[model samples]
Target: MGIRLCIGSVNPSKVRGVVSAFQSYFPVSDVRAVKVETGLPPQPIGLDVIVRGAELRARLAMSGDCDFSTGVEAGFYRFGSTYFDVEAAYVVSRELGESLGFSPSFPVPPWFVDEILSGRFRELEEIVDSLYKTENIGEKTGFISLLTRHVVVRSELSRLATLMALTKILNRELYEKGALR
Candidate 1:
């Protein structure tokens, strides 16, 4: 059977990044994505809240009998005077004999904190989409878009960082189960 993995979100940018990430593993079948509640509060922060949010969606996606599932939650964590926000993903595989639980991974770059504090990219995905034009969605394409264009493109970084975290999760899970080459 093909990799029939399901994404826990229906956001277009998320769908594109995740599908691109998993394409190498499961190219034949499409990356099936379903809309599910992340259970995250209006303003999510802290590692516990983020992990819980991801777990909620991961379990929901897995319950649908998918071979694998991916869930992403973006939030900001404050460390003393600085605040760092990033998109994190939790990947789960159903092939494990027992519940392998969930793997948490994310990209933490120096500028990520500045962007969050600068209030440019309140929502990382939206900022990135504005820069990359990945989805061509006109929700934030107006003249009043409030995201920083300094440093790398926000959308590319956000999506690339998220994809990297997912890739790491996939590699870690596969290696732990001796499925990795």
Candidate 2:
């Protein structure tokens, strides 16, 4: 039987990314999108929180029928005085347990971070939308697409993160032998 997968979000970009990533590795028989709560703030901060959010979503999306479930979340983390935006992907399977992966980080302006921290904005997308006069930017090209001049998009980020998370599953023998541990 082909692989059956479920994703914990209804976001178009995320769904496309996860589906594309899985298709690259396996013949996915069925793909389902479910709206699952992350139980996290609109804008998560810190690496742990971001990863936890992904895992939570993945776990919530898991079902008896699907072979695997996935969740993807984006947030900011600090390095020195700079805040960088990053996306986390978590995959859960009955046999393989769980795997986590992250996308490349990009620095966001300090002022933008300040605005988010100050509670002036609920999320970075909101601020970006206001600035660019674009609505629901996260569902479209994403802020990164604008920053990189359309070279990289939100779906690409999700795809990269999902691929990374699937590394262990793709190389099951190596992982079973603790190659990546």
RMSD of each: 7.0, 1.8
Write one digit per residue (lDDT tens) for candidate 2, span 25-133.
8899999999998779999999999999999989899999989999999999999999999999999988877799988899998999999999999999999999999
Superposition error at 17 for model 2 (Å): 0.6
Clashing pairs in 1: 128-155
Give the top-scoring candidate (TM-score).
Answer: 2
lDDT of each: 0.54, 0.92
Q: Which stretches of candidate 1 lie above 4 Å from their native place?
A: 96-181
TM-score of each: 0.60, 0.95
Model 2: ten consecutive residues of lowest lDDT:
171-180
In terms of lDDT, the best-performing candidate is 2
lDDT of 1: 0.54
